[model samples]
Target: MSTQTGRCYCGAFHVGTKASPQTVAYCHCSDCRRLSGAPVAAFAAFDPAHVVITPRWPDAKSHAKGVKRWFCPECGTQLGATYDYLPDQVYMPVGLFDQADRWQPQLHSHADSALPWLHIDDGLPRNAASSRASLTMASCDS
Candidate 1:
């Protein structure tokens, strides 16, 4: 019953999903931090089956065991994110929606690797490390 829409930076990759999401989490792992080029990366989960993707956007280079990324080939915009391991839903870059504040982060992952200078006092759960261990601690109550 839940439905949402998102698009890539160049609007080449458009997505329509019909799942609200079990929870949304932030990743502070080295890969995430480096890929996002930020202190952390934010992602919202959706059922992969409920997502409809428009393959007009350029393909992305993937790493990790079960994840793939989509971006604008011409602009190199970090347009979208997805996970194959879970296989039920998809994850979209909250940035692409311009509704970053609408969905609050459930936790801060990889607190163990967080930059010493960065302060994480968002009042959300803080995971000392980046592992399913941290994610288990972040089980969304909602």
Candidate 2:
């Protein structure tokens, strides 16, 4: 029954959630890197029913099949995303959360795609590809 809130870079968009995240993890896929403009991107997956976006969620854009992303119209900050495969959860960038420090990633997804220069020896589980099975199980647990 914890609540987390955050706003977009330009303060044009806001988000809040009443429940804890189902999972938190790092994504090293090229798609995520380009979208986040970072070597790696971390996300916290939440049940859509527990999350609220002020004003409204922007229209989603799908550059890749099965993946739809939303961005703030004012500053273009990546807002959130949903995957057709993971219909029940929405993935929001960890950096966008006011309590980002509290949501450390539990695993590395698409580890094989991770940049060679990036060395994170946090001893977290590394999945060579999408950790959909693990992610799905985590949601079920919640």
Best by TM-score: 2
**Model 1 agreement with the true structure over 84-118: per-residue lDDT tens digits:** 54455455656655445777878776667778887
Residue pairs clashing, model 1: 46-89, 46-90, 47-88, 47-89, 48-88, 48-89, 112-128
| Model 2 Cα lDDT, one tens digit per residue, 1-142 | 8899998999999999998788999988888888888999998999999989989998988777777888998999988888777888999888888999899999998898899999999999998888887766121101
Write down the TM-score of every candidate.
Answer: 0.75, 0.93
User: How large an RMSD does model 1 have?
Assistant: 4.7
Residue 108, candidate 2: how far off, in angstroms? 0.2
Output the number of the lDDT-best candidate.
2
